[model samples]
Target: MAAIIGHILPLALGVALSSVPIVVMVLILLSPRGRWSSLTYLIGAVIGLLGLTTLFSAIATLLPPAPPEAKSPLIGTIEMLIGVGLLVLAAIRWRRGRRHEHNPAAGTPKWMSKVSSLGPIPSLGLGFILMLRPKNLLFTLAAGVAIGATGATFAEAVVGIAVFVVLGISTIAAPIIFAVADPARMRRPLEGTREWIERNSSTVTTVVLLVLGTVVVGSGLAHY
Candidate 1:
């Protein structure tokens, strides 16, 4: 389980470092309907991560058993594909970020502005969608495949998966924790962060995708 956690941590942290989702969740927490929306959004995000893990893990069982050498190549191939996709995504975002770096009219996603008006259920749904953004989905799917490659016992597997889900969602859930603990202190710092991310989300996304994609590619190639 520790090995699984160590192996998957970078991908999970890349997911946790996503700016748009964190920004959206922060906006929800600053809304008039802040408390409920924030909580539901966090809940929905957690559910999404766990749900994807479960789906991939189950799908993994459908494959016929193979020797360790044979199995690593197949799983590694999937990871490599995911890495290449992310690298391409990173390049696109990097160029886009550069293109818009000086455009005062450049705008963020439409949904970002809509978070404050959302009711609890819609907030939950939005939470789920935000967490499943393409980069995050691909990273989580890669982690899921890695988990499936483990030969841990069923009990150990469950524990490892739980660790992944918790760590993966930590940054997304950050505001919720401090909201319940100390909203006053958190608000100022978070608000500053929100504005910064709003302006630089594309760059943030690009950097994360580049680093995570490189690591995932290295991990995949190491399998051979």
Candidate 2:
């Protein structure tokens, strides 16, 4: 478990560092019936990420092993492909952001206008959707592949994967944890924080994707 943890922790942490979901979580916290809505969103995020990671890891187990010589390289190939995909996504997002910057109104998600109208169930669904965006899904898949590439034992797989899930949810978790520490004074700050993050989410995500994608590709290449 320790060995597996040593290997995959970076990827897990990388996946967890997304700003958009954290912003969305804070948004939920500021919504109508916010107390439960945010909590439900957090719950939904945890479930979505953990469940998807588990499924991917399980699927990895079912895949036939590559020939010994090709093993590391095969994993590397997959990682590189995922990295390239991420880079492409980053470019696409960057272009969209540029366009949005020029036409600010088009950049707004209609959902934001209706956040105050959300109930617990919708909040939960929104949380799940926010956490499961394509970039996140790919990152989770990359993490799962890294885990499987280790050929981890049962104990190693369980513990290592759990750690990955925890780290992956850290961004959203941190703010909520802090708010829980002082809900009274935190509300206004949380809302302000959310707005700031939302305003910068695209650029942040694009940078994150570019950096992580480069790192993932390098890691994959190093397998050779």
Candidate number achieving the greatest lDDT relative to the actual structure: 1
- lDDT (10s digit) by residue, model 1, range 74-185: 7667779989988998998888888787675767767578888998999899888876788878888877776766665677667767877888889868768888577778
Please list the residue runs of candidate 2 whose C-alpha ends up more than 4 Å from where it truly belongs after superposition: 1-3, 64-71
Clashing pairs in 1: none
Q: How well does candidate 1 match the true structure in TM-score terms?
A: 0.92
Query: Model 2 Cα displacement at 224 (Å)?
Result: 3.2
Model 2 Cα lDDT, one tens digit per residue, 124-175: 8877887678888888888777666567777777877789889888878877
Q: List the candidate 1 regions with Cα displacement exceeding 4 Å.
A: 64-71
lDDT values for all models:
0.80, 0.77
TM-score to true structure, per model: 0.92, 0.89
Clashes of each: 0, 0
